[model samples]
Target chain A: MPEIIRFGDRGILVNFEQKIEAEINEQVIRLSEDLLHQHGDSLLYTIPAYCSLTIQYDPKRTNFKALSGSITSLLNRTTSPATSSHRKIEVPVCYDTTFGLDMVEVCANKGINSATLITEHTKPTYRVYMLGFLPGFVYMGKLSQSLWCTRRRDPRLLVPPQSVAIAGAQTGIYPSEAPGGWNIIGRTPLPLIQPDAEEPFLFKAGDLVNFKAISLQEYHEIEEQVKTGIYNLKVSYGF
Target chain B: MASSHLALYFAKPGLFTTIQDKGRFGFQAFGVPTSGALDQAAADLANQLVGNGLDQPLLEVTLMGPKIQFQGNGMIAITGADLSATLNGDRLAVNQGIEVADGDILQFGRPVSGCRAYLSVRGKWIIPTWLSSRSAITQNGKHLTPASIVQKGTTIRIDTSLVDPLRSSSAAIHPPETDPGIRVLPGPEFDRFSRFSIGEFFSRLYRISPDSNRMGYRLQERLSSFSPEEELISSGIIPGTIQITSSGQPIILLADAQTTGGYYRIANVVSQDLDILAQLKPGDTLRFSLTSFEEFS
Candidate 1:
C-alpha cells in the first residue's frame, strides 16, 4: 500500500516504497494512467516519478481530502493493473572516442578495457522509469553493477545532446545540451525530443530500451538521414 | 471571425518580459515546466480590470518594465508592481484601467516596491499556443514562442472586436500589500532535516540572490546547520517548492521551475504567499514563517 499525503494545499503526493526499483516505478506509472483516465478533469496535472506520483488539483474543483479518499478507494479496487500501451525502443549508439568523452576515464575507474565496458553497458535491457530533469530525457536504471560509477565531482557546464551517460545505478541520454555530471560513454545520433512534432517525446514512462553499438561510419550515415528527416527509430510496440 | 490587428509594439524590451497565461498544463510528466505568471493574484487582478478572463495571456514585466508604444487604441491595465509608469510623459497608476490612443508610448522608471508587474490589454491575445497555453518558455534549447524572450521591436497582436467599452470605466481595487515574511508548509522531507537546520530556516533572514530567474530563486545565505546523510531521488516538484541544496542553500522554485529535482524539499511556500515572493526583487530580504496545513486550509 502507498501513502497519500498532502503536498502543500493544492497538491497530493502518493508515495510508495522510496527506492529505484522497476516494480515500484511500474505502480507509479499505472496509477498515473488511472488518474489521467478517471480523474483527469479534476487534476491540473500529475507527475510520475520513480516511486511517487504528485498530483496537482484545482482547489476550486477538488480538495486534498476528497481526492486522497478517491485515490485510496481506487487503489483498493484495482482489478489487475491498468493495461496501457508500452513500447520497446532500440537506439543505436557509437562508443567511438570522438563522441565518448569520458570512456577512458570510466574504463580506468571500473578497472576494465573499452571493449569490456561497451559490452557491460549495452547488456542491460533498461526500463524507462520516468522522464524528468529535461524534456524527453529518459531516466533508465539498473545498469550492470560492474559499470556502477559515481557522478563527476565537477559537472560539465554543457553535455552535448543525445550523449548516453551513466551515473550511480542509472543511465540516460541527454535530449539536449545541459549541465550534467554523468560519465559520457557513447553518443546517439537520433533526436530524442521533437518539441514541434505531433508526438513531441520519443520515449515515455513504462517503455523499454535497448542500446545497440554502432560504428563511426554508421553513426555519420544515420546522422545524415536524421538531418534529412528520412531515418525512423526502430520501435516494437506492446512489450 | 475578426482578424487580429497589431496592438502593442515593444520599442525597448524590459529586463525580462514574457507572455504568460494560467500555465501550460497536462505536460509535467514529460518534464515540461509550467511557465506562467509568477504573481497569480496580480495577473488575475490586471486581467479582471480589463474585463478579460483570468487565464487570458498577458505580459509579465520583471524588475524594469518595457517601453511599449501602442500600435492600436485599446484599454489596458497595469498592476502588481509600482514601476513609476507614464504614458506619453503622463504618470499612470497601478490597478487602474487606462484607455490609450494609437502611437502612445508607455515607459516605466525605477521599480518602487515590487520586482514584477502585469500588463493586461483588453482583447484576445494573438499568440501561439504550445501545449495548449500561450505562456512562453525556452527550455533545453527549444522555445515555445518564436523568440525565447520578448525582444525589442516585437509587435503583439490582439482581437479587439469584442471589447466591452464599460470595462475601461471599472473602478480600481487596491492590490494587497506583500508581507515581509513568507509563509510555508513543511515538505515531505521536512522531518529528515535536523532541528537546528529547521530552526535556522524559519529564524534567519535570507536575501534573494542576484542570479534568480523565472526558474527559481536562490538565497544569498546558506543555512548554518544542514547536512543530510542520504541523497534524495529526483522526484516531482512544483512551483513554490523550497528545496535545500547540498550546500545548505534553500532555492524557491518559481513559475518556470523544472518538474523534477533531486534536492531535499524542506518546505513549500503557501499558495497565497507565492505572489509575495514573485514581487520580491533580487537583494530583497525575507524570513520564513512556518504554517501548518490546517492553518493554510
Candidate 2:
C-alpha cells in the first residue's frame, strides 16, 4: 500500500509499502510518472527514494490539502503492475589505486584480495533505488550480502567527484566534490553532471546500471573520451 | 530619452550583503539549494517601493548599505534597517521613496535598529541570474569575493526605460517588533526531547548568539535535558528546521542551509514568522511559543 504524508507547508511525501522488494520500487516509479503526467505545474520536483516519493510544490500556486487528497486517492485506485519496463544503463568504472582511495582500507577490513573484490563488485547487475544526498548521486542496492559493510565513522573531508562507493547495502557515485563517509572502491570516468550539456545527469531513478571494470590505461582513454565528448554510453530497456 | 546609472564605493562591507530575490525553486531535487534573501519582508518591500513585482530582485544589504552616488534623476527607497542613512550630507527618510538628481551621494551609516536592510531603485538593476535567482549563496564559495559591500567605482547598471520615479511610493505595512514571539509547530521528532527540555524551550528567554548567519541562528540557552543520540540517518531538512545540537541548544536553520541534516528537529517556525526572526540581531532575546498551523493562520 502507498501512503501520503505532509512535509511542512509546501511539500508532500508519497510512501510505498515499506519494503525493498522490486515490485515496490516499480510502483514508486509508476507513481512518479503518474504525478508528472497529472500535475506537472503543481509540483516543483519529485524525489524518489527507496520506498518513498517526496513531492515539493509551491504553496502559492498549489493547494496542499487538495493535492494530498488527489495523490492518496490516485494511489488507492492504481494497482501494482507485475513488470517494470525501465531503462538499463551500463556504467564503465576503473577500480584502481589511483582513483579508488579507500580500496586498500576496504580490502583490509573485508579480508579480500583487490582482484577478487573488483570481480565480485562488477559481476552483479544493480537496480537504482533512489537519487539523493547530492545531484545525480544514485543509491543502488542488493549488493552481494557478503560485501555489505557500515559507513566510515569519520567522513572524509572531500570525496572526489564520480567516486563510486559502498556502505551498508548501498552503493552510489559522488555527483560532485563533497564530504562523504562511504567506502570508495572504484571511480567512473563519465561526468555525473554536465551543466552545459543538453542532458546534464547521466542516470535517473528506476534506471538499471552495470559497472564494467576497465584497466588503468582504459581509464585514461575513457576520461579523455568523456572530456572530448567522444564516448557513447550504452542504455538498454528491461521488461 | 534618458539613461542613468548608480555608483557605490565600498569603504567597508559591514557584514555580508548581496543581491537577492524570492529564491530559486524546483532545483533542490537536482542538488541545488534554493538560496535567496534572508529577510523576505525587506525584499518584498523594496520591490513594492520600486513598482517591481513582489518576486523581483533587490539588494539585501546586511547591517549597513553601500555608499552610492546618483548619476541621474531617480527615486529610491531604503527599508529593513535604521542605518543612519544620509543623502548628500543630509538625513534621508526611511520607508519612503526620495528623489535624487545627478551628483547626489547616498551614504548608509551604522545600524541603529535592524541587522539587514534593502535598497531598491526605480529601475531594476541588471545582474546576471543563475538558476533563475540573483540570491548569492556564500556556502557554494562561487561568487561574491571578500568584499561584501558594493563599493566606490562599482557601477550598478539599471534599465533606465523601466525607471518610473512617479510610481515610487511607501510601504503601508509596518515592520514587526524586533523582540518577536516566535511561533513553532511540533516536528516529527518533537517526542525525542525530555519533558523538562520542552518546558525550558518555551519558558527560557534565549538570546540570539553572535554566531548567527543565513544558514542558522544559534540561541544561547541553558537546557536541562538532551538526547544521547548525536547522529541520525541524513534526511530532508528545510529552512525552518529547529535542530537541537548534542549540547541541547536550539539552532534554527535559514535560507543558506544544507539540503540534508541528521539532527533532531523539535519544531519548525512558521513561514509568516520567519521575517520576524530574520531581523533579530545578537543580544536580542526571543521566547518560543508552540502553536499549530491552524493557530498560525
lDDT tens digits, residue span A16-62, model 1: 99999988898898888888898888899999999999999988877
CA displacement after TM-score superposition, residue A109 of candidate 1 (Å): 1.9
Q: Candidate 1 has which clashing residue pairs, if any?
A: none
Best candidate per DockQ, number? 1
Q: After superposition, how far is residue A138 of candidate 2 from its true place, in Å?
A: 3.7
Judge candidate 1 against the unseen true structure and give its global Cα lDDT, from 0 to 1: 0.86
**Predicted complexes: DockQ each:** 0.68, 0.26
Q: How far is each candidate from the true structure, as Cα RMSD in Å?
A: 2.2, 4.0
Q: For each candidate, give the interface RMSD after superposing the true interface residues on Cα.
A: 1.4, 3.6
| lDDT to native, each model | 0.86, 0.74
Per-residue CA lDDT of candidate 1, range B21-47, in tens? 898889999888888888898898889
What CAPRI class is candidate 2? acceptable
lDDT of 1 at B85: 91
